[model samples]
Target: MEKIRLRDIADALGLSVATVSNVLNGKDSKVSPATRIRVLEAVEGSGYLPERAEVLLGRNPSRMVGLVVNDHPEYSGHPLEDPYNARFISFLQRAAVRHGLELLVKTARTWEEAAQFASIWNMAG
Candidate 1:
């Protein structure tokens, strides 16, 4: 199914995107209560879910955590296919969720590859 975006909801309600954004972001003080209700109703009906990365990036440093698995191609191409890596990743995922973090997993054949992803994402420790 195609994803519904915030702009779609705003257009259907005949409201500006900014107004809809304000309502979704809990900054609805300037928006009329009736309009706020309408916007929310439309949003729920449309099933629009905002991107988590965008919301996290709004905060200082971001809430993104990267888990890089150093995989040896000699053993297997897929890092998560290994039982040990899978177990460790499962633990890390639970811990990250408990701390309100978004976990991004990457399997790198080389340290350089891992560093590249970490640098590009600016993943927090």
Candidate 2:
């Protein structure tokens, strides 16, 4: 399949590419809420992937932090069930939101899986 670009999203939402770019770049103050919703919906629905270069350059609002926890053999239940894990995630989520970042929590039994997940998502620790 062809890669989805910002222009495609803009066309899908019937908005200018510049407007979509602004929204994705976190400069949406000039864009209307309705338009922003439409843009975001289109982006999500189309499974659009922004340019990695843009994300790395901090041009896009794709600042994401990955939280990896390893406690599989010792713990039987989900990681969220642990009080300490829950509290840590809560604090991390709050900090991420406050700084306009996205927090992705992933639990892996092995280092390989954790590394794979982080590599796939281009996540920063």
Candidate 3:
């Protein structure tokens, strides 16, 4: 089967391609909850992948920041479960937004895992 396009998703959902594009681009304020859920479901169920041009355009405006947290043994599998980590991340997120950056968070259970995640995402130090 051919890879799904934004137009194909829009046609299936009875929405304009721009609307679908905005939804996929994380502009949720422009879409209603019902429409947003429908679009999300359709995208997930159909396995939609944005084209390279679309991906580049989306990234061109801002930089992507990846936050990889290694869960501490005392934190029960997630460092964010502790208030300190949660608060720290919140501050980081605010700072990133203020600087016009996109934040991507992931849990890295070990040093190896963190390295793998960074390499996979092409993260900058």
Candidate 4:
């Protein structure tokens, strides 16, 4: 069996790669139901799996906020020892959910590692 790329499927369906990519990634905002179904069928037949991060990055922000909690021992102890931090984190999560936004949480052991991760994820605060 031969592997198929997204471009190949798009070409076969007489659609632009971006249009096909959007359909495969589940962006239904600008896509009609009929077109979405067709693209999905083509994708299934082609055995192509779109990259999730690429899809996510292309999506419009829906009140989504990424949170990075540096829980290093030097900063804060276990949740049992520092209940305030835990409570704050819980509150943020609840607030994000209430607003229909996803909260991405990341923990780092070292300050350097935290900085690097923050930079990579564009979560600098």
Candidate 5:
């Protein structure tokens, strides 16, 4: 099915596109409570799902975080070897969860792959 547009809601409510946009984007502090409720009901009836990243960015605290670790001698070798990297990742995951953020760890197979992965995930050493 096709997605609904902000203009559609604006036209339906007899409001300007900018006003509808502000309400939908949750920057409606200047808008009246009745107008806010109308906008919310319109969104629900239209089955609109806001982008997760945008919503998270709008919140006081974000919900996304990333972690990356290069190859350490302690974490390399046989699977039975001491799982230092695994333990560290688990700890980081727990800490992130406690703070309401997600933790992602990725292992790169080569230096080139590692560089590419870092660029993709926006990580820096």
Candidate 6:
């Protein structure tokens, strides 16, 4: 099914696109309760993903930070078990959280594998 756009909902309800946007964005202080209810109903009926709504409005990338770590057969535990690696991971995690992003730690055997991780979500870090 095609992802529903705000324009479709607004047109169906005879409302301006901005009004529908405001209701979805929780900026509906000035919108009437009846209008809010109508817009919300349309949204639910459309199978719209709330996360995608922000992306459509702002064209934002997937807010993820990917950490590529090397995995060797001889390693006992996670590569992050090393003290230096652990500290670095902790710092990176803190930064990602501070910026409203998530840290995805993955072990890769080669550069090609690491590249796949980055491309999957448009990883920024």
The candidate scoring highest on TM-score is: 1
| TM-scores of all predicted structures | 0.51, 0.50, 0.48, 0.41, 0.41, 0.47
lDDT of 1 by residue, 86-119 (tens): 9999999999999999899998886656754664
| Runs of candidate 1 exceeding 4 Å displacement | 1-60
Error of 1 at 5 (Å): 30
lDDT, candidate 5, equals: 0.63
* Residue 123's lDDT in candidate 5: 24
Flag the better candidate by TM-score, 3 or 5.
3
In terms of lDDT, model 3 sits at 0.73
Q: Write the per-residue lDDT of candidate 2 for residues 1-125, one digit (tens) a residue.
A: 88788888888778899999887666889988999778867776786666664356454545789888886766785877788889989999999999888899888887656754565565545
Residue-level lDDT of model 5, residues 18-108, one tens digit each, is 8877876558889999997787677658744444433444536545566646655555643223477668778888988897777766554
lDDT of each: 0.78, 0.76, 0.73, 0.64, 0.63, 0.76
lDDT of 3 by residue, 36-111 (tens): 8798788768866555434544554437678988776777886877788799889989988898777778886776
List where candidate 4 sits over 4 angstroms from the true fold: 1-52, 74-81, 119-125
Error of 3 at 44 (Å): 32
Residue-level error in angstroms, candidate 4, position 55: 4.0
Off by over 4 Å in 2: 1-61
List all candidate RMSDs to the true structure. Answer: 15.2, 12.6, 10.8, 14.8, 16.3, 14.1
What are the clash counts of all predictions, listed in order?
A: 0, 0, 0, 0, 0, 0
For model 2, what is the error of residue 70's alpha carbon versus the real structure, in angstroms, after optimal superposition? 1.0
Best by lDDT: 1
lDDT score for residue 36 of model 6: 86
Alpha carbon lDDT of residue 49, candidate 4?
43
Model 6, stretches more than 4 Å misplaced? Answer: 1-59
